[model samples]
Target: MRNTQQRKTEWLNIQWKGGVMTHPVQQDGSSCGVIVVLMAREIMKAFPNVPILQFGTSRKEMANERKMMALQILKASVFDEAENCSMCSLKKPTGSVHRFINWIQCDTCERWYHEKCLGMAKEDLEQARANTWSCILCS
Candidate 1:
């Protein structure tokens, strides 16, 4: 028999308001699990009702803290730290010079990450490759 009494925290909305940009809640950004949508799916499997909370802050102090944390994480992003490669930095003109097509190369693998795609950081990706590592998605 399964224990229905044990309640789990499932849904989380992480709203970030930076300068002029705000990214809505996302599961991956919170480091909670795989895709954010999957969190809802998993919760549905175990319980009918799930508790959700919005992370970060409504107050200035908390907001500052949240911003700092975000800065730290972003600083370590592959775009900032990884070595640039040809395939990673090419762009196609869109209007007069090419406005619609911009391409990015993977820091570790040197493959292309298109306008709407994201990839693992080169350092982490390289470490994984060297250690024979595979993530859940890869595995």
Candidate 2:
């Protein structure tokens, strides 16, 4: 197993280059690799164990899948955090102790939610441990 930090770097170093990312870019290379690596670090920290599927034999397919996986990871992390927000209650009286979750997001699709409107439990939402949480729509 690769070190977590190095693993992240290696994954992000991959890029779409003339339909193949195996070769390093000789020009404008340093910036793109660094940017992607940093983005990967943020995404991996936010979402763990996101599936990366590549069915086609082409390198393009592999590259696309990797990009999609990274996007999904970021989406998962965003949704996981949004589900716990407690600002969604519209009918609650002002100065209420309970902070309603106003912006809940679907873990699969990245759809936003209004807690009360979406009929989700605050406790249940807050108790979610993984970024793979699914919303009612996705479920």
Candidate 3:
């Protein structure tokens, strides 16, 4: 039966009296939820003895930590996916030439490979636009 404002006020009062503090305002509205979750987890991990309400970290520091964590996770996922690929035997292809070419992916194995590795010419790839090319292992 409590109104929203009254509920919020009660919550704030509880937090204030309990020594729980507020995190800084998010710079962007888009990732506020993510920031809050990440900050809470990090704070809990770093300061288990401290009350969460009393624990505070700068928004800049939290954002930087979040960014770095995201990058590390992404890199790890990429590495895992590359390891799963049977064609290159876990070695990612090097050189700008490999980057420029339109790589084909296997439907069955979900592994990616260069046209040259599959013995498919550029013209052949162009000609077989609508056809799905399966890798040799899958074929």
Candidate 4:
């Protein structure tokens, strides 16, 4: 047979070199994306050495993966890191706070940080040598 464009495009089933491996069937409707991402992570971590032991994910595990994936999305996010606290560096800090009061700013660089994010506790505020306290980078 002559080499042809049709044959090249048609090579999927007829020309497959290695045996195919099947991913486990999705159990939950919403977990499809999570399962795909989980599979990729598992492959990257274990390929060429260890074999994957399981792929049947439970609904509870999917829920956990959803949170984990959200966190990963935030941490691996493309948004401006400059807006985040230099210490924790998360795009947004959690919980209720009065920004002007609960958040503190460095006297030097002027970067803002959540009170909980600081290494110093509220009690340690009195122990500070001077009224002005610098952020970790500034100090």
* Candidates by TM-score, descending order: 4, 3, 2, 1
Error of 1 at 115 (Å): 13
In the range 1-139, model 3's lDDT, one tens digit per residue, is: 3435834644433443456445365545455666667668767877857534432345666677678778877877645543334555444454434545556777777777755555677687776556776778878
**What are the clashing pairs of model 1?**
88-105, 93-97, 93-98, 93-99, 94-98, 94-99, 94-100, 95-99
lDDT of 3: 0.60
Pairs clashing in candidate 2? 86-99, 86-100, 86-101, 87-100, 87-101, 87-102, 88-100, 88-101, 88-102
Measured on C-alpha atoms, candidate 2 has an lDDT of: 0.51
Top lDDT prediction, candidate number: 4
Cα lDDT, all candidates = 0.45, 0.51, 0.60, 0.69
* Residue range with the least summed lDDT across 10 consecutive positions in model 4: 94-103
lDDT of 3 at 92: 44
Superposed on all Cα atoms, model 3 deviates from the true structure by an RMSD in Å of 12.9
Worst 10 residues of 1 by lDDT: 87-96
Candidate 2 TM-score over all chains jointly: 0.26
* lDDT of candidate 1 at residue 125, scale 0 to 100: 56
**Model 3: what TM-score?**
0.33
For each candidate, give its TM-score against the true structure: 0.20, 0.26, 0.33, 0.37
lDDT of 4 at 50: 69
